[model samples]
Target: MTLYLLIYFIIIMGAVVAVISKKLINSAIMLALLSIGVSILLFAYNAPWAAVFELSVCAGLITVLFVSAVSLVKHDEENIKENRVKYVLLPLLLIGFIISASIIVPEYFSKLQIFSTYNTQKEEPIGKLIWLYRGVDIIGQLTLLASSVFVIKHIFFKRKEADNGGKI
Candidate 1:
């Protein structure tokens, strides 16, 4: 229980820091931290495959893409106007929503228990489940990763073209 709470705290703090960060790189790093926290939580919940996927795709791949994208963009900090009040209030609002959901969501789920169905069959091994039952999900994840790579490559190509005065 204490470990779960600690992970949750890390996730919340990471999210808040990501949202409030002034620099894009810092935000991307915090987002990776958030994904790591989530991956840990999934592992704690006995979902190793999900945890691995979250760590690899979200924390590793997406963070790299975000950092690369942010690096490619020219920052004109002096010309950018930020509303500080929004950043200050957003985390507070998020905390309030989380608190309310914690209070309300359990009761709602408890009520739903009456209508829920349980699978009493023995669980398949993770390897069989992944390759046999969840082949489509695996393919989808691969497709998403491939598409993101292609998109990033396309962005780099365009930036290179612009840098070379459209000579490509």
Candidate 2:
């Protein structure tokens, strides 16, 4: 219960920071944090498949895409004014969350039946289950990944061309 509350707090704070952040990179990082918190919550709820997918696609892939896009944009960091207090607080908050989670998560998982070592019946292998039962989801995730990569490539090339006065 306490762990769930803490996770919820992290998710909410991350979302608020992501929306209000002035820098694109900060927003992207916050979005990743938010996704990670949600993933942890999903895992605690015994939804491992959903948790993994959320962590991989949202936290991993989308955050990479966001950071890549932000890197492509030209920005003069020296001129942008930022609040130092929030920057300092962010790390402290993360550290506290990590420490608390480490202590609580193991105990929480021990109570879950899914994480238990003993099973009455043998279960299907994870690989076979995913491929056979969730084939369409796998295909969709792959397609989304491919399409996002091409879109980013196109945007980068277009920006370069525009910068070069329409020369590719």
lDDT of 1 by residue, 50-99 (tens): 99999999999999989988887847643589988999899789889989
lDDT of each: 0.91, 0.87
Q: Which candidate comes out best when scored by TM-score? A: 1
lDDT string for model 2 (94-144, tens) is 779989999999888878857667767988878898889878999998999
Tell me, by lDDT, which candidate is best. Answer: 1
The TM-score of candidate 1 is 0.78
Q: Which ten residues in a row have the lowest lDDT in candidate 2?
A: 73-82
Please state every model's RMSD to the true fold in angstroms: 3.5, 9.4
Structural similarity to truth (TM-score) of each candidate: 0.78, 0.54
Superposed by TM-score, candidate 2 places the C-alpha of residue 70 at a distance from the truth, in angstroms, of: 0.9
Cα-based lDDT at residue 44, candidate 2: 100
